[model samples]
Target: MTLDCFCGGVRVTTVKKPEFLHACNCDLCRKSGARWGYFDPSEAAIDGQTSSYRRHDKPEPAVDVHFCPKCGSTTHFRLTERAASTFGDTMMGVNMALSDQADLVGVELRYPDGMAWSGEGAFGYTRESRILGPDG
Candidate 1:
């Protein structure tokens, strides 16, 4: 699947279809309004220029959320060393809203309460569709 940012400044191409898509209800996610498809950076080719942001309070390792500066659209996110160690590989949260070629059938769609992730791991997640997974 190939995705283009609102301003066409960012582009991402996935070698294979994503297995999981997430709809998170956290402060950042809620405001951004993007459903995310998760994949290892190795699974996709992400090209383009984007601006990044990260919360300072209790930040996620070196995770950086990136967006198209021109369109102000959230495009993707990348994790740093710490998150990579815990999560196995560096994963990118590709914004599904930006892509028109994504094939989501049978893919697991998840609703996670990112606002209250207990660290014991998502105790408040619901498998909303055939599309969200931890298989990443």
Candidate 2:
């Protein structure tokens, strides 16, 4: 799959289908207006010089959000060494806003409560979402 930011400054390519598609209600995610798709670093590739925002809320396992330089659209994310160790070394998060909505028509979405994510707790999933298009 190939996707790009609004102004086309950032581009992403996924070699394999996403293992998980999430619609997180985290502060940052809510503001950015993007759904997420989880994949291995080797499975997806991002091409661009994007600006990144590192969440300072958590000390370890940094989750860096990367946005397009031109349109400032959140495109993807990169996990730091600590995060890689905490999760998987190769895990990456892709923002679905990079792709056309039609392309995501049939994909299922998982709702996660990232706003309350804690070190001692696991993410609380709220619900499942499905794309409802003309076909439906």
Give the alpha carbon lDDT tens digit for every residue of 1-136 in model 1.
8888877888988887667678888777778877888887888777888888886766454567888888989988888668778876767888886766335555767788787874464448744445423332
Q: How close is candidate 2 to the true structure, as a TM-score?
A: 0.85
Where in model 1 is the C-alpha error above 4 Å? 59-62, 85-88, 130-136
The clash count of every prediction, one per candidate, is: 7, 0
Query: Candidate 1 has what TM-score?
Result: 0.80
Among all windows of 10 consecutive residues in model 1, the one with the lowest summed lDDT is: 127-136
Report the C-alpha lDDT of model 2 over 28-136, residue by residue, as the tens digit: 8889987888887888888888998887766664678899878899998888767777766777789876676667666777788887777556788767666535342
Clashing pairs in 1: 107-130, 107-131, 108-130, 108-131, 108-132, 109-131, 109-132
Number of clashing residue pairs, candidate 1: 7
